[model samples]
Every structure is written in C-alpha cells, then in structure tokens.
Target: MVVQTTNNYNASSGELWPLLFNSKMDDKKPCYLLCGLPKPLECRLPDKQGGVGSTRECVSDKGTIQQRITEWVPGHKLSFQLVKTDLYFGPCVESIIEQFVITDNNQGGCQITRTTTFKAKGPLSLVVAIPMFIGLKAIHRYVFSNWKRLSH
Candidate 1:
C-alpha cells in the first residue's frame, strides 16, 4: 500500500531541497522515537552527481534504517529505496519506497509531498500499516514544519 501526504510551505523548492540534501543543515529534533535509531543521529551527506545511488543510514536505540537514493533531481525530487531496516516490524515489512517532491505553488511558496510505498509480507503484516502510517505522518509533519520555519 502507498501512503502519501503533502504540506505547503512558505518557502521555495530551491530553498528546501538544498537543506534536505545537506546533512549539516538538518538540526531539527526527530519526533519518532519508537523504532528508529537511538539518540544522537549521524548521517552522511550524499555525493554530488545528483546523489543517485548514494546511501544514508541511521542508527538509534537498537534499530537501524538504511536507505539508498534511487532518484534525485536538485530542487525538485528525491526518492529512496529502503535497503535495510531493523525497526519494530522489520520482519513483517517486505519492502519500502520513499519519495519527496517539491513544486512551486501559486501561493508563492512551495508544496512538498512525501510518498511512502509499503509492501507487506502477508495479511497480518498489513494490519501493522495503520500505526506505521500514523507514526510516519507525525514525523513527516514535524520535519516539514521545522524545514519551513528554518527556510524563513
């Protein structure tokens, strides 16, 4: 199943995309703490060349999520494939695809959309989707809100 959420920000895609790519620019506190990496998170910034095929890993608590950049377009879009994850429901999750899209809006700012595609192992695994999406939505909103605020 695919879950998508979009939020409008009072910032241009040019302003937000660069921050998303720059590891040093992210200083917002993470909201989700149940299944992701532990406290002080460390991320490696992707190389230039559009960052395609670059990977980012996060380790927290006792879990870790490793994501690879599958597609990247500066000031436009970024997509990732969940290469590995040891989260709360890792065994039930078959695969995941995450994407972010930024586009200019008529409101003079930009619209940022986050899309996550999840493949479950079976019917029981599908049941876990609800809570997973709820947690994800919260984290996304928190991150986007911080991004918007920082863009000012």
Candidate 2:
C-alpha cells in the first residue's frame, strides 16, 4: 500500500529545504510526537553524502527503523528505503520507502509532497499504512503551521 501526504507552503524551496535536510530529526519531530514519540528524538545519519548507500537510523517511542538512502537531489528531493524496523505489524511488513519532494511553485513559494510506500508480506499491511498516513498528515500540518509562524 502506498500512502501519501502533501503540503504546499508559502516559503521557497531554498528556505525550506535547508530546514528539512539539515535537521532531519527536528523535521520529523512533529509527526513522531503526535504519534507518541517522546521528547529528545534520536536520529543518526552518515557524515558524508555517499549517494544511495548511505544509511540512517531513527528512534522514537513507536520504535526504531533503519533506512538506506535511495535518492538524494539537493533542494529537490530525497528518498530512503527501509532496511529494518521494530514495527512488527504481525510480521507482515516487508518494506517501506519514504520520500520528500520539493518543487518551485509559480506562486513564489514551494510545494513539498511526502510519499510513503509500504509493502506488506500479508493482509495486514493496511493496518500499518492507515495510521501512518494520518500521522504523516498531522506532521505536515504541524510543520506548515510552525513554518508560517516563524517566517513572519
């Protein structure tokens, strides 16, 4: 199952991409918090941009997940492939890919779309995707709200 959450903000990609790319954990904190991840989020990424093979680790109250960078386009897009996750989901979870795309808008700002794809080993895949979809949206909204307030 593929779940997507999108957001268009009044800020330019140049302004937003740095915040997202530089502060990966802080960028994801809103969703993690809404979904019950505690304070002090933990995230680790390689110091070098070794292209697709670069690995990352993210830990929250929900659990920990390991990911490998699949794509990286500075100020444009980023994508990661899930290598492992503590989210058992009845052991039916096979893989997950999370992507964020930033595009320049003609309206003088930027549009960022987040797409999360889930591949399940069993029928319960939807069980994980649904809540995740909702949580992702909530994260986007929170970010947008804060971005607006801060940009002013």
For every candidate in turn, the CA RMSD to the true structure comes to: 3.4, 4.0
Cα-based TM-score, every candidate: 0.77, 0.69
Question: For candidate 2, what is the lDDT?
Answer: 0.65
> Model 1 scores what on Cα lDDT?
0.71
Alpha carbon lDDT at 108, candidate 2? 78
Clashes of 1: 4
What C-alpha lDDT do the candidate models reach, one value each?
Answer: 0.71, 0.65
Report the lDDT tens digits of candidate 1 across residue range 1-152.
77788988888788888656543325545564555523323334445434788875545445767889998888999888888876766887888898989999899899989898987777777587776776667656666666666688
lDDT of 2 by residue, 1-152 (tens): 66676667788777776544333334445654454633224456746443567876665556767789888777788788888877534266677788889897778788887787777665666676666566656655655555555444
Query: In model 1, what lDDT does residue 20 have?
Result: 61
| Top lDDT prediction, candidate number | 1
